[model samples]
Target: MHIVITGAAGFLGQRLVTRLLERGRLDDQTIRRLTLLDQIEAPVPDADGVEIVAQALDVTVPGALDEVLASGPDVIYHLAAVVSSAAEADLDLGMRVNFDATRALIEGCRQHELAATRLLMASSVAAYGGELPEVLDDMTALQPQNSYGAQKAMCELLINDYSRRGLVDGRVLRLPTIVIRPGRPNAAASSFASSILREPLNGEDAVCPVPTDLEMFVMSPGKVVEALIHGAEVPGERWAPFRAFMLPGITVSVAEMLETLREVAGDAAVARVRHEPDARVTAIVSSWPARFDTAKARRLGFEGDGNFREIIEAFVDERP
Candidate 1:
C-alpha cells in the first residue's frame, strides 16, 4: 500500500514515519512507498525495501492537495496543524491552516474520488474544552473553549460527516499533550512539556509558564504513533467507538513532573526550572482536560503510559 503523511516533518509525524519504517507492513509489499509532504521538507528515511519521497507542501494554499491526491495513496495521515498557542494568537491563520485546510483536503479527496483512502487526521485533546473531568467518554460532546479547540471540534464533525456519506473512510484521534519531543520547541502550547526537560538537559534554565501545580493530560511520542497505527488498522464496524478517543498518558501536576525530574536527573536539573506563571497561560492550561479514563483506548489494545517519572526518564533517553 502507498502511504501519504502530511505534516510529516513535525514532531509526531517524523516519529511515526520512523516507526512505520522499522515495522514493515503485515501484507507483503503492502507499504512499499511512503510520500511525506510538509511545509518544511521532511528528510525521507532511506530503507532498502521502501521507496520514500519528501515534498514541499503548503496545505493552506490553493491547488496544493489537488496535485498530491492525483497519485492516489492507499492511506493518508493528515497530521498538519498550526497548534494551540499560535492558533489562539492568530485567529484567521489558525482557522485557515488548522481548520479550513483540513476540510479542503477532505473535500478535495472526496471530489476526486480519492476519499476511499484511509485518512487519519491528527486531532487533539484540545477538542474537549471548558473545565475538565476525571473521565471523558468516547461520545462526550465537544465544548471547546479556545479557537484551536473549537477548530479541532469542527473538524471532527466534518470527519464523521464525510465518513457517514461514504466520501471517506477516516478516524480522528484526539491526542493528549505529547511528551519527550526532540529538537526545537513548536507552537503547540503543550510544547512546554518537552521543553522543560529538553532545555534542562542542554544546561539551560527553562521557564515554567504555569504554576507547579498545573495539571495536564500527557503522553509519550511512542504512544502517539501507536494511537495513529491503531486508528488505521481497526475494523470498520469497530471504528465507530473509535471515531474519537482521548489518547492520554499519566495525568500529573507540574509539581509532580518537577519531582520526577529531580529523581532521575538530580536536584540540580530540577533546580534549572524556574516558575513565572502567565495569566493567559494559566487560563489556557486550566481550561484543558488534565485527566481522562481511557477505557475505550484500553479495550482497543492501546498501551504506553505510567507515572510522570517514567515519562521523564523516557524523554531523557529518547532525546539523548
Candidate 2:
C-alpha cells in the first residue's frame, strides 16, 4: 500500500505516521511507500523497507498535489487545515486551505483515475451547532456556526458526493476536541483544552478561557489515530448512504479536567490554571454540543477513552 498523509507535521499527523510505520501496513496490505506532505517539510522516518517521501508544499496552490497524486497513493489521510480560530480570524485563508484545497485534492484523485482510493479526512465536532439537542447522534444535522466548521461541513458533503459517484472511497471522522496535546498551543479555539492540562503538568502557568462548567466532547490523540486507521480499513459496503459520523468521545467540563489533573499530578498543577475568560473562544466552543450518542461509531468498532482521569494518566505515562 502507498499511503499519503497531509498535515504530516502536526501533532496528530506525526503520531499517525509513527503508528503506521510501527504497524508497517494498512487495509491488511503491506505499506511499501509513505508520502508525507505539509506546508513545511515533514520528518522522514527511518524505515527499513518503506520508501519515504517528504514534501513541503502549499496544498492551496494550483496543481500542488498533482505530482503526489501521480504516484497513485492507495490511501490518503487528509489532516491538513487552517484550524478553528485561525480560520475564523481569516475567512479567505480558511476557505482556500480547508475547502478549496480539499476539493482540488479530490479532483486530483479523480483526474489520476485512482478509483476508490481510501481517503480518510479529520473533521471536527465544530460541524455541529445552532440550537442543538442535549445529545447529538449520527442523524443530527450539520449547522456550523463558525468559519472553520462551515468549511469542514462543506468538505464532508463534497467527499460524500464524490464517494457516491465512485470517484473515491472517502470516510470522514467528526473528531471531538483532542485533549492533552503535547507542546505549545496553536490557534484553535479549543487550544485551552490541551493547554490547561499540558502546561500545568509541566509546572507552567496556563489559562482557561471558558467557564469551568463549560462542557466539551473530547478524545485523546492515541484513540483518534486508531479511529483514522480503523475508518480506512472498514469496507465501503458498510459506509454506504453516508460516509461521515462522529468518533466516540467522553464529555467533560473544564473543572472536571482540572480535577483529574489534580488527582494525577498534584494540587499545585491545578493551582497553575487561571480562569480568564475570552469571549471569542467561549462563543465558538460553547456552541458545540458536549454530549453525543455515538452508537454508530461504537457499532463500527471505534472506541473512546474511559474517562478524563484515564486520559490524563495516559498522557503522563507517555509524555517524554
Candidate 3:
C-alpha cells in the first residue's frame, strides 16, 4: 500500500508517521511507499522495506499536488491545517490553507480517478460553537463561531458531498483539543491547555488564559494517532450516510487538570501556572463544547484517554 501524510513535519504528523513505520502495514496490506508532505521538508524515517519520500509542497498552490497525486496513493492522511488561533488571526491565510487546500486535495484525487483513495482529515471541535447542548453528539449541527471552525466545517461538508458523489472516500474526525503536547507552544488557542501543564513540569512558568473552571474535551497525542489509524482501517461501508463524526475524548476543567498535575508532579509544578486571561483566546476556547456523547465513535471502536492523570503520566514518562 502507498500512503501520503500532509503536515508530516508537525507534532501529530510525526507521531503518526512513527506509528505507521513501526506497524509497517495498513489494512493488512504492507506499506511499500510512504510520502510525507509539509510546507517544510518532512523528516525521512529509516524504514528498511518501505520507501520514504519527504517533500516540501504547498498544497494551496495550484497544481502543487499533481505530481504527488499522479502516483495514486491508496490512502492520504490530510493532517495539514492553519490551526485555530493562527487561522482566526489571518482570514485569507486560514481560508486558503485550511479550506482551499482541502478542496484542492479532493479535486486532485478526483482528477486522478483515485476513487478508492481514503482521505482521512483532522478536524477540530471548534467546528461547534454559539448555541450548543451541554453535551454535544454526532448528530449535533455545526454552528461554528470562529473563522478556523468555519473553515473546517466548510471542508467537512465539501468532503462529505464529494464522498457521496463517489469522487473520493473521505473520513473526517472532529478532534478535541490535544493536550500535554511537547515542545514550545504554537498559535493554537488551546495551546495553553498543554502549556499550563507542560511548562510547569519542566520547571518553567506558564500562563492560563482562560478561567480555572473552564472545561474542555481533550485527547492525548497517542490516542489521536491511534484514532486516525483506526479511522483509516475501518471498512468504507461502516462510514455510510456521513463521513464525519466526533472522536471520543475526556472532558476536564482547567482546575482539575492542575490538580492532576499536582497529583503527578506535586504543588511546585502547579504553582508555576499563573492566571492571566486573554479575551480573544478565552472567547475561542470557551465557545467549544466541553462535553460530548461520542457513542457513535465508541461503537466504531475508537478510544480516548481514561483520565487526565493518565495523559499527564504518559507525557511525563515519554518526555526525554
Candidate 4:
C-alpha cells in the first residue's frame, strides 16, 4: 500500500509516521511506499524495505496536491492546518491553507486515482463552540466561534459530501486537546496545557495562560494515534450517514492536571508552572466544550487516556 501524510513535520504527524513504520502494515496490506509531505521535510523512520519519501512544499501552491498525489496514494492522512490561535489571527492564511488546501487534496484524490482513496483527516474539538451542551455528543450541532473551528467544520462537510459522491472514502476524527506534548510550545492557544507539564518535568519554568479551574477535554498522543489508525482500518459500512465524529477524551480542570503532575513528577515540577493569564487564549479555550459524550467513537473501538496521572507518566517516560 502507498500512503501519504501531510503535516508530516508536525508533532502528531511525526509520531504517527513513526508508529506506522513500527507496525509495517496497514489493513493487512504491506506499506511499500510512504510519502511524508509538509512545509518542511520531517525526519523519516528507519524501516527496512519500506521506501520513504520526504517532501517539503506548501500545500496551497498551484499543483502542490497533484505533485503529492502523483503516486496515487492508496491512503492519505491529512493533518496539516493553521492552528487555533494562528488561524484566528490570520484569516487569509488560514482559509488558504486549511480550507483551500483541503479542497485541493480532495480534488486531487478524485482526479488522480482510479479507485476511491481512503482519507483520514485530523480535525479539532474547536469545531464546537458557543451555546454548547454541558456535554457534547454525536447529535450535537457544530457552532464554531473561531476561524479555526469554522474551517474544520467546513472541511468536515466537504469531506462528507465527497464521500457520499464516491469521490473518496473519508473519515474525520475530531480530536481533543492532546496534553503533555513533547518539545517546546508553539502557536496554539492550548499549548500551555502541554507546556505546563512538559517544561516543568524538563526543569524549566512554564506559564499557565488560563485560570487554574478552567476545564479541558484531553487525550494522550498515543491514544490519539491509535484512534487515527483505527479510523483508517475500520470498514466503511460501519460509518453510517456521516464519516465525521469526535473522539473520546478525559475532562479535567487545570488544577487537577497540576495535582496529577505533582503526584507523578514531584511538587518541584508542579511549582515550575506559574499562572499568568492571557485573555485571548482564555477566550478561545473557554468557548470550547470540556466534556463530550463520545459513546459512538467508543463503540467503534477508539480510546482515550485512562487518567491524567497516566498521561503525565507517559510523557516523562518518553521524554527525549
For residues 1-320, what per-residue lDDT tens digits would candidate 1 score against the true structure? 78889999987888889988887872244578898999989998788789999998789998798876888877889999887888889999999998899899889879879756788888787788754456767667788888888998888888888887778887788888887778777666666777888778777888888888888888888878987877778754566733667765678888887887777888888789888777876777777887677777777677757677777777767764
Worst 10 residues of 4 by lDDT: 108-117
Candidate 2 segments whose C-alpha is farther than 4 A from its true place: none
Q: lDDT (0-100) at residue 293 of candidate 4? A: 93
Task: Give model 2 RMSD, 1 decimal.
Answer: 1.2
TM-score of 3: 0.97
Question: RMSD (Cα, Å) of candidate 4?
Answer: 1.3
Backbone clash count for every predicted candidate, in the order shown: 1, 0, 0, 0
- Winner on TM-score (3 vs 4): 3
How far out, in Å, is residue 102 in model 2? 0.7
Q: lDDT score, residue 173, model 3?
A: 95
For residue 17, what is the lDDT in candidate 4? 89
Model 4 scores a TM of: 0.96
lDDT (tens digit, per residue) of candidate 3 on 62-110: 9999998999999999999987777877999999999999999999999
Q: Taking the tens digit of each residue's C-alpha lDDT, what string does model 2 give over 1-320?
A: 99999999998999999999999988889999999999999989899999998999999999999998998989999999988878888999999999999999999999998777999898999889888889889999999988889999999999999999999988899999898799898877889999999998888999999999999999999999999999989987688788899999999998899888988889999999999999988987898899999988998899999999989988888888
Best by lDDT: 3
Q: lDDT of each prediction vs. the true structure?
A: 0.80, 0.92, 0.92, 0.88
lDDT (Cα, 0-100) at 176 in candidate 2: 91
